[model samples]
Target: MDDITEINTKENRQLLYKYLIKMYGKEKAKELMFKHKDNLFGNNSLAYSLGKRSIVFYCLYFLQDYFVPKDDNTVRDLAPVHYDIWRELEDIFIHHTHDKQQFILPRGCAKTSIIDMALSCWLHCYRESIYTVVLANRELDAINFVEQTKIALQTPYIKNTFGELVQPRKRTVNKLELELDNDTKIQAYSSGSSVRGTSYTSSKGKNRVTCFIADDYISEADILSDESKEKKYIKWQKEVEEAGDDPVYRNGKLIKSGTKFIVLGTPLAKGDFIDSIKNDPEYKVFHKSVVPFDPDEYFENHTYWQKFKEIFFDNKRENPLQDAKEYYEANKEYMAFETIWEKYSHFELAKKYFNKKLVFMQELMCDVDNVGDSWFKSNRTMPMKEIENHTFIKTMLTIDTAGVKNKDAKRSDYFAFVVGSLADNDFKYVRQAHLRKFKEFDEYIKHVISLLKENEDITHVYIEKNTYNGLDVDAIKSEMVKHSELMKRDITFINEMQRKNKDDKISTIVDAVNNGRIIFCEERVEQSFLDQVMSFAGQRFSLHDDAADCLSEFANRIDEIEIMKNITTIPRGWLF
Candidate 1:
């Protein structure tokens, strides 16, 4: 009986060894063989425990693979970059999801893809019916993003999960609506299109809103002007932001996703949401650059990653172009690659491309410094501290029209006009500030007329002949002519010739500001304007500070109260 039992035990051991050999291979199986050498080895041993764990792991992995399709485009299982952004958004989803926060990212980075996938997953997988509104600066951008998202969903892997569950359809050219099985639907709308007035009614329409994404609401050039474009941008931001109100929690999240609005573009030359965020104390902004830190390891691990860095040379200081070349030579790979070091390179780029001071405040760092060799300082631009409460008269207005770029939405300073006094140093609170950004040109014309009516103390109006491709100047004159027929007041629209250098004019104005001759409105005007004013580089104005430019030109063109020389010269000291 003992011999028969021994033979049966040997047979069982042989079968187990064969299975182990097949699973773990010969070498690993040999290691396991010793683990099971003891009579009690099967109960407790390193190899025995590892064998058990491996089996359990494989079983779980197999189950997950079977249930979850290989192409699950869900946010949770997105690519690494998408996953990182999703993680940032996940916190927002649970807490501040309803609050409108602007998101700015560069182009061609699959931002729309991630957003659409996230929305779809949030809706179908989580079974949450969300009222999501996706807006773009133009109808084309909005349509393209939505269509791409729909196509992504149609991928074989994505279809396997929620294909029959939710049907993605393009109800219109500018509208993409998806119907879910649970009677929950998502409707997409474009800000540039007529969808602004579209009804937001729902079955349970008790203030229903889940997400709002405004992608590339403004281009770089549009945001830098002091015309209607700036105004339109501000207005759209306010209206779209207010659209996401939820009576339930009274908390709705609004996201502005675009490269220009956030970062990855030239520093704003005019006032923008980015400027507002930097200036507003109540709004705590969390800005994270794409590659905020050294991607040495990441780049080393994945060499295909390409980075674009811009370097600048200050010709005023050293040979700027030469300095840049040498700098590039010393740090060739790092210079060409986007990394933590590239941010420093961006500072150089800002200095050379735009103005050093502008980039410093708007890009490299958030600290707004007034000290620099700027057009304002060189031109003796004055501060309100010196000119405040001075008796003066005869206010004139100058308009910088931007009608061409502002065709999509009128949220830009396309028509930036400054109303100030030429004789009276006492300018009435910087009133004639008009930013045009509405669907209709008539709205802008009316706004400008209203400004004119309010500031009745004005004697003359000067419009830049080339403002808005010169056509706008003509349009304004035509509009004024039409208004003359209706109103008894005689307001003449005169065009200014661009014979002199605007930079020299700007430089002269800068000298005035620095000499404490020209004063700015403390309450109404933003420090961003001042920062922009003081940071005006000698020539390449970049595109953000048009209002400041208008203010500078208006300030410079008007004769000073008195020629006060030698106020404060930059003390000469060290030459290293």
Candidate 2:
């Protein structure tokens, strides 16, 4: 069971025969056992039989020497999971059970090299007059697949084993076509190319496509662009799927069969072509995300793994399949690494890779829903009151001021204030947040003075300086002079100016919120204030950005405030 290569051995064949006998009765098992025995013989027909029966054996044994890494000439075996997937695909191909198959795998899992190139070569060499068409998002990608197929066929190990069987009669890079000595042909086409009337001719004078493989038909750029998504959807339906209409024929006579279509790629968007195909009844979907809901359980109880046990060992379990929802319910703890923490990591990767969250979800988890848009979710926030034990180092007040004559206007920028303590230089616990629209400059000053009186720990008041709403040093100082008796403590008022864009400022707060560096008071902070902060789109200006602006300002200036807290005292004669 450990060594996959052992399945091809003679001793395992006897064991397999007995298992088959127990499952399919004596007569059928004898016929199957004889076929297996015949396939093990050292002959050309035996080689064909082995290749036809097991794709894993064909790749690992027959094509092992040829499929070496270009840089080091080292042969790396496919992962056990990959072999299991290939075997299932082989069964579908040999039995002609499904007309379409969709394979969703991670980025570097070798779906293109193993299945698109090596398996295509095996099919061409083993089957007589087989026709195939390879398609991709771009012309260059299609050409690469065709070139890889040619390279696979021309390898010394393959050429020596099959000799003239795999030799190309005509290999044209311009046309992206490869015609084998056995009259098997493969052509590559881009997604939008005209493939309506395309057909391959066999030695027996039959013309049709036997197989169609589409790799990465959706690109990341296409998913990001709304215009491109619309056009690509139309092209996928009109051109790629319709290309399989090439009629099959046997012995120069028309047949009722058509080409078997296989669409392979990581899902890009929620309702892209891959999603459409999964919803349609025509295609048999085979989706394998790199990180499932429960990573440990997926490795043990996946449907493909169960299928592998059934096919190879004739072992069946009562419960063989577990969907994403069931796995999440059973193993909720394991899901956090992928769904929550990794999403923040993905945000960093998106900055580095210059891609979006859509690409990250699709490539890593095969998740279709776009997640990176909302920088902060409601559940990510923790209540400050929930902290059981913490030392409060310093209390600071950050303000985003708005000016309006009317104190009861509906459509005006809200004056936002955030009073929080820097606890242990790591956590920012918000004690209170005051958010209101259409407050006069005098009333706003009185309100801030009252807050400063109430919160005696507040030593610094950081006000966002702007030309509008009479928010300036002199205006605030004049109001402070009027209420000098209330401000018994020497409060340092800092005129903070933001030099960066609003989006960049919001991103700073996003990192703090995501890393659990900030906490809000459940009772003191208004629900409306939290709602505005959570719902603020980082990219565009929303209807209300006061709460988000205040939080971002606090996050941006917290370090500076810490540096000030280190200063014990200032000379009374020192001028500002």
How do the residues 78-184 of candidate 2 rate in per-residue lDDT, one tens digit apiece?
45557667766775666556667888776766789867887688778776227788878899998888877777777544554466544443443344878777667
Evaluated at residue 369, the lDDT of candidate 1 is 31
What is candidate 1's lDDT per residue for 1-576, written digit by digit as tens?
112233225534554466567667878877776655653122233323332333222111212232223465332232344445544454454334324444434333445544444444443333333455566656677667666545443443223323343453522222466545434445555544533434434455542344555555554445434564466456655665445444332244344321111111222443554555434443334444434543435433432222111223121233444555666566566535352222235324322223332333334432223322354542222345543354455566666655533544523554566777643323233433444445566666666666677667555566666644455545655666666632555455566655554543554444345423345555434555556566666444444456656776566554432322337665577433
Positional deviation of 566 in candidate 1, in angstroms? 55
Best by TM-score: 2
User: Each candidate: how many clashes?
Assistant: 62, 0
Work out the TM-score per prediction.
0.40, 0.53
Kindly report which residue stretches of model 2 are placed more than 4 angstroms away from their true locations once superposed.
1-43, 66-77, 164-170, 173-175, 192-194, 200-208, 224-230, 246-256, 291-361, 369-375, 378-512, 517-530, 536-576
Q: What TM-score does candidate 2 get on C-alpha atoms?
A: 0.53
